[model samples]
Target: MSAGAAAIRVVVVDDHPTFRIGMSALLAATPGLEVVGQAASRAEAVGVVLGADPDVVIMDLDLGDGSGVDATRELLARRPEVAVLVVTMLDDEHAVYDAIRAGARGYVLKEAQPQEVERSIRSVAGGGLVLGAGVARRAMEGLAARADARPFPQLTDREREVLALLAQGLDNAAIARSLFVTTKTVRNYVYAIFTKLEVKDRAALVVLAREAGFGGDER
Candidate 1:
């Protein structure tokens, strides 16, 4: 990021000509932001970003050729130092998480304000994570939904037993005594149960487990 009197280099990748032009103009008008290239497809985006060696890339999620997620993965795999800021019409939680999982540092909807886009670019270039308005909250909600979406399909018999104990309002120490195991072993089982259930905390696990009828006397 240390450029002596040089603006941050940026590349814009979107299928629409109007959006590309508009974004380029916005970047040009902003201080310390420079639009170095524009591309219409994922392949072209990869080529342009690679050739330009831009500090930041504004990537659209859907290109005629391929997905921006794949392009972002490819770009980072080739050059780990490059920062990718995803800009797309799609603002769904899954899309945002996909971009982040593919190594994008920022996610912004196409409808984002010019100032927000510029701020996202700057944030990514400065090695910070950024999410468009409501994107982060939506992503967390999606995760929470996933936690309760299904029964504990990934749990083994022992893990399910641990989950049942957890749902029965037993703490780790109490569950250890009931299961005739060490507290450390109970803790490990609790951790595994949480992972298998895809819940973030014991409270979430209890809710999901109760819904799944895990607190019954079947065990």
Candidate 2:
């Protein structure tokens, strides 16, 4: 959906000038999104974010001044309303887990296609989290085996119910119908599950379910 005529305002922060420029152009042209500012270092990033007050911050993992993870934490602490989305080459679990802990709304590998990056921006801005495809699954498996932030957490009963449905490959609509709730309600549950379980998306949800010895029928 277009989600109304107002576009998603965003700032691109990366150490690489080329990456900052390329992402700025790509995101600006995407539907329902606009690149309001750009920065190539940690200091510049903070300036752009504070100056633009954008809805989303597309941040690189390695900036000129420091790791983007640091920036993510600081930004959230400073501006709790503004969201950070990590878009970089770092695929390490530490990076992914740290970013999430730092209050990142989404994590996209640099290898993710341009479309995926744009989709992530929208997803996070729309109150959802995006995890790298396999990351979610791996996190789940680790969770099933051990309660670790590797990056799963203590999933509550209701959250586990939601995750189970997600593992069955149910979309928000189907899950809502099965649970006799509204789609918006299901979306909220899914987001909570992601944060609590430390899984990123449906694919990871499934992997974690299997590793935990759960099936669609288990719920």
Candidate 3:
């Protein structure tokens, strides 16, 4: 940004009041950003962001009342000129893809350093696409996988779920607990997934899953 340039107006959209307050404070402290509004849900996000007409929007994926992805789509649909920066807790490739599809110009995980967040906002405001650290690799893998065509289009939904958890580095025991299934059941699902995907082991399954952008909300 040029010196003495007008501050980039911003809107913060998250369900949590504390997060909204903290983010507002952070942007307020920044030299070239101005927080113009905050929203707690999808409806509020649309109304607030449109009303504020911000240069950039910091969006959360889970907005309590609805998905941030949906809000991003709506916000851009109304005002395509506004840049959206998704600041969400979700770090998976599928989440990144969703945000990108919804017209977000940037994605930053909530766990990132404050500087990273600020930089992402600036980058998106300046007409750049910014992915959180380590996310670009997964996104690239996912794009490659999709370009290659789905190897196993017939894998059952349950098997896909199991594979997604595997890609997240979850052990069989953890997957079983998360899915509310027995370890033996999870093992059976894993074997089925491997057979369907033509993979030999957990490592191979993870590779395939990452390439295919398998990480999403299983619940």
Each prediction's total of clashing residue pairs, residues at least 3 apart in sequence or on different chains, is 0, 2, 0
lDDT tens readout by residue for model 1, 69-111: 9999988999899999998888788898889999999998887
Question: Which structure is stronger by TM-score: 1 or 3?
Answer: 1
lDDT of 1: 0.87
Candidate 2 collision pairs: 136-204, 137-204
TM-score of each: 0.71, 0.63, 0.65
What candidate 3 gets wrong by more than 4 Å, as runs, is: 141-219
lDDT of each: 0.87, 0.82, 0.88
Comparing candidate 1 with candidate 2, which one achieves the higher lDDT? 1
**RMSD in angstroms, all models?**
8.8, 15.1, 14.4
lDDT tens digits by residue: candidate 2, 1-219: 555668889999998888889889888777788899998888788877898989999988898889898888888888888878899887767778888998999988888888888888888998898986766665566556665532334676666777777777788999899889999999998888777667777787778776775554656
Top-TM-score candidate index:
1
Candidates sorted on TM-score, descending: 1, 3, 2
